[model samples]
Target chain A: MRDRKESTPSRMAAVWVRCGPAALVLCAALVPLAAPSISSYIFYLMFWITMASAFNIIFGLTGYLPFGYVAFYGVGAYVTAVMWSRLGVPIPLSILSGGVLGVALSLLFAPTLRIRGIYFAIVNFSCAMALRILVANLPEAWTGGSLGISLSAIYNPNASFYTMMALMVLTIWTVGRVSGSRLGIALRCIREDPEAAQVLGVDVVRSRLKAWILAALFPSLAGGVEAWYTAIIDPDSSFNLLITTKTIVYAMFGGLGTVMGPVIGAVSLYALDDLIWGKFPMLNLLILGLLIVLLVLFLPRGIVGTVTRRHASLRAVIR
Target chain B: MRGNSVILEVKDISKHFGGLTAVNRLSFEVQEGTVFGIIGPNGSGKTTSLNCINGLFRPDEGRIFFRGREIQGLPPHQVAKIGIGRTFQVPKIFKRISVMENLLAPVLSSPRTDQELKAKAREHLHSVGMLEMEDRLGEELSGGQQKLLELVRILMFDPQILLLDEPFAGVHPTLKTLFYKKIHELRKQGKTFILVSHDLTSVYALCQQIIVLDQGEKIAQGRPEEIKRNERVIEAYLGR
Candidate 1:
């Protein structure tokens, strides 16, 4: 029998193996911020990466593809706006409150966990749409109704960009920690077979809830930052379904379950979107649709997933 | 069998799916440290009864008691935490993860440190002669290997009662003998087992007490020898 104790050096080595690439990527992202000409685009890349990584926590790890993930983002943005405008809370604190609100709103939909597969996705999408309409029709006094909130007083693109960059790093770190933890293993087991995981002593509901809450927090924080960056938000913009779709596409395009997959997917695809969106506005959608189709058909596992499958040694380092 | 004390008791449990009665008014007692065999023809509810005992399915009627505490209707994870470990009929191993990961999952839920859990996982995998394939993905394993991995994976929890559903199905003869030996060794260590299998020879050899079911009803219950001669069991196996 092998020894039951893992030596200290081996544990340290495992940590280094996981965190090294993440640190390098964080440094590379930071270096690009120095170039002001494309700082806005950098912010966009960071925002997408953070959002896609967050989406992956639930969809990739636990196999719960939440179609209404943007609901949390919209809720976070509105919560931050309300806190800042009505209660006169500071920008940073309001953003933090937005994350908390994201978690709270996710709890409201926690019962949907009982529903599985494509049904859950449909129900979640409906809930997001319902929430959007409810916000739009609410009395103007509290929510500003369809008019939305304008925080031009606190609008600072540079500050918001830096804040988003920090959040992107945090999101990557969170994914790394989760992927290496026991909770990650339980999540994967639940993804594979919930009944089997339960019989093996994994609390399926609780593990999934944890992943959901974590996933909610990231997009919520990102939304709060984006709201401040834009200085104006309406119900249509706040609860945009396109954000949810784009996040899912980016995560899938990069790979699911690995730390670098969402990052790679978001960076490559967001850049392509930026390049083509202005010149060929109508063709952008068609091109994205074609790319996603091709990806699904030829590279179903995404870039990192395909690479890892082909090379065994790279799996430990990349993940 | 070392103890006469009953470790698990099922009392008049019934489970139904729409018009189909999968398990009907079945009751059984499993003594501690004994191999209790459950044998029935296809669709006879052997798997259903096991599912009920392990909390995979809630009984429509009656109750299940594990170590004198009612366990029926509890979630599967709660049942596992209460010391009931089970394997599925088709060997539901986590296909995307490594064999080492498969073994570590149950122990991770326990209050064990990472080092100790890894060590325990390695030890279990070695014991099952799968140490060499520890890093391979679960799906990469052959059918017999997957079954062995599933068994060893559950054993990591140190479960008091094991509900093994057709552990011998599709397994190699050598692995089958190894499984039987392992079950006997575990029994010797005071672990209780409710084995559901279609392999009659091993079932007859291993179980001191056996039950026969037909059409979701228990038709006979006795020692293997008596069960062999029972007319209803003969009719159930060979058809009327």
Candidate 2:
């Protein structure tokens, strides 16, 4: 029984498994050089990919739905913008500082984890809103008040595009590792039944905090990268409610808990969003709203989750 | 460790939930390697007592000594780390995860390599005839299988004392026999168990000593035969 393998895939399936992701990432990396016109579009895709996947760590694995996820991204953007524009800190170091602060904020919000489900979501959203309000009222010299800051002095889309792509890859790799590791298992256990996990010797609170910090790190960096790409940072845009909604929608549309769910969800949904925005700008929000309603009504588990659940054979393959 | 033989000592532990006193000044002792039974009617503080002992709920008052170390208000995982494990009345297996992962969740911090842990998990599953279902999601298992899996999962951590809440409730007769045999086997191996259930037959059959609770208080404590004959227990619980 101990020697039993999970399953033996066909030789072709094994080859495809090994080459598929590498090929996809290589193509993704080549986007800026191959088609510079669509590079910004691709940058946004990677940003959402990184955002959705990072969100999956806490929301998908640990059963937290952080409705105010933009708080980290907003803070990251401000931190990077302030440091680079005002203090003359290097670009890379500013982004790193943003990520560090995002983690610090996650620690500060750790107490909210004790409150579960919708209550957590509500508190998290309120926290993000409060932060946005606070940022908007800061001294004009420091945070540029409501006027915002412009890093237009160091504007470089191509460089930031690649950074966002790299961040996407790193986020995917980290989430993938976590999804298959013991920590992931413990997280799912907590998600399913925290008290039971507790009596089983899994440190539920500590485990959740680890996922929270991991979830915070990438979004903050993505925020900084996006700030660099846009060459601007304002409280309203940086802490947009749409950021949280879009990431949550994308991750849920794919599947919450699986590795490939968010990746596939983000790519498909972002493309769909772009297509609609181009063809039917007025109906864009309406269509996306209708699609989400359909997703919740029919495929509540998201694509990967529903498919794998219905067809057990695809569990190993899809994930 | 009253004579270095008592494995668990509950000293006047009480628990309250707002206006309700779920467990009031409950006290009992279990000797090492013995099967101790806690039986009571519904809402009689049976489960609450076990929860307090396992650190799921901190007692409002009194200290619990496990092998002579006072541990009343510690978190459940810390209590588990100190070698006490528990199961829920409704087998709280990780429904989303595979049986193998459920088994592995508790012992992720073990010094053993992943291979060793997997091998041992498989061994435990095999012991309970669940080795074939290791890859199945816990929710996919039947209730009886889930209960067995929960038992095996807790056993994987090798706790010195196990608090089983309603282990025999809703179990099939064959599975109950299996549980009975497993309890006997574990007792032989020097593991102490506090079995909480209103399933008096199995409790009487397995327990070396029994304690009866009624309305958050201990109404009786004795050997199974003595508990069976106790007039107060009959009036509070056993009577028709």
Candidate 3:
């Protein structure tokens, strides 16, 4: 998962880079048959993979750190829950509608792209908070208000788990393709220097909007799938800031710009959280905060980035 | 293809940042296939005037016409798309990406295939003696090399007009010669240029028409010999 670690031979690392994605998909797909008890853990892992990778499109590629990223996720969850439970839409259609509505929500938030850096992040965070309050105040008959909507009757852990796994694969695949494409290059240019990119004839605004929409899409689907799996969608859990925090940490821990960085980051960090932090719930946040500080101080580029920087040969293989 | 037609017209443009006027009622016109030089001291609005032409800053007052089209208030990318390109004082290359990627970034919207674009990039890099360094990251290049890379990247798009801001501020002498020759070659191909620099030698050698700015106002505009004899231009550069 860490690209054959530091000492592995280049030949072996190249092979791993080629076959790793397929191997991950196969293992995740067959996890339920191998161990039924750990399905919930695997499901959560896939959820984070999707969330973090989707987030990297905008944050890593276009240099837009969206603190309110969970807005799309929360809206997707509520949209899926409401559509399925009240509107009587099919499950798949309901989840797809969640994604569509997320894109629509992104269009509405497009004006925020005019600003950059911490100002953009603060404005985006406020937008998400406003949305949470809006949902909380909605009529209970429609939104279920603070009580939240429940579709516990149709809950199928296996179905939602597989759906999330598929989504995780799709997200990683999308990021891989984008990281190598012209659009990716344009976004990276914008990230490096937006004004320079504009002068160089890169449509900074249009490129950013594209990345923003892409970053919005997958998290919405992930949220919808998570809501289905838990058989409940609540405002507090759905729009939690922890979701954004964990996604950012996972992506940063692995490496932001690369395709597999977020995947590896999410998997390793989520496993660590479950193993260590799950037991000491009170100390979980303290440890996570300390880890972030250490990461920034020591390995600002994250695990894969630092490794690649030291060994440039691994760039072609690892990427 | 060289003609006396006015290609770019800056009419009474003024840009203000809070209480400070960066460029005030500065009017100039550039002819086709000619190098127009703007010389000034540290804060004389040379860069701001370029910014206004390329749409980085919308002048508080006035109009800019490019090829008979008003483009004063348009966005920078829109200005670039309309065949105007620019370089910054400090090189603004995409430091994280490869040199090849930096070249490709500007022309991503081109209809050419990736292979075709790569070959073209290689050709341009080879012309500038940067072909061997295509695989290197932009940040690995020296300051002079970064400026060279930026200029080459701008040339890759083949813009109609180039607004170069201090293109030779930190360049090596040999690379400066190469850049000077490249500008001559570009002008021979009928490309227009607006050169902003404090290097009066380069300005005198390269420009067909030169304007001297002082504190956001154009104090002198004429041939290089006339500007050399202008007392106000001498005083602006050397102090009264």
Q: What is the TM-score of chain B alone in each candidate?
A: 0.98, 0.97, 0.99
Q: Residue by residue across A1-319, what tens digits does model 3's lDDT show?
A: 1122343456677788779878878887888776765888889999999999999999988899999999999999999999998899998999999999999999999999999999999999999999999999998988898989998988998899999988988898888888888899998899999999988888888889999999999999988999999999889999999999999999999998888789889989999888776689888988899888987899788888878777766776666
- Candidate 1, residues B33-90, lDDT tens digits: the string is 9899999999999999988988899999999999899999999999999999999889
Candidate 1 scores an iRMS of 2.9
Give one digit per residue, the lDDT tens place, for model 2 in A237-298. Answer: 99999899899989999999988899889999999999999999999989988988998998
**Whole-model lDDT values for every prediction:** 0.88, 0.90, 0.90
Proportion of native contacts kept per candidate: 0.77, 0.95, 0.82
DockQ of structure 1: 0.64
Stretches > 4 Å off in candidate 1 = A1-37
Candidate 2 lDDT score at position B25 = 93
- Tell me the spans in candidate 2 whose CA falls farther than 4 Å from its real position: A1-14, B1-4, B238-240
For residues B131-179, write the lDDT of model 2, one tens digit per residue: 8887778889999999999888998889999888898889999999899
Q: State which candidate has the highest DockQ.
A: 2
Preferred candidate (TM-score higher): 1 or 2: 2
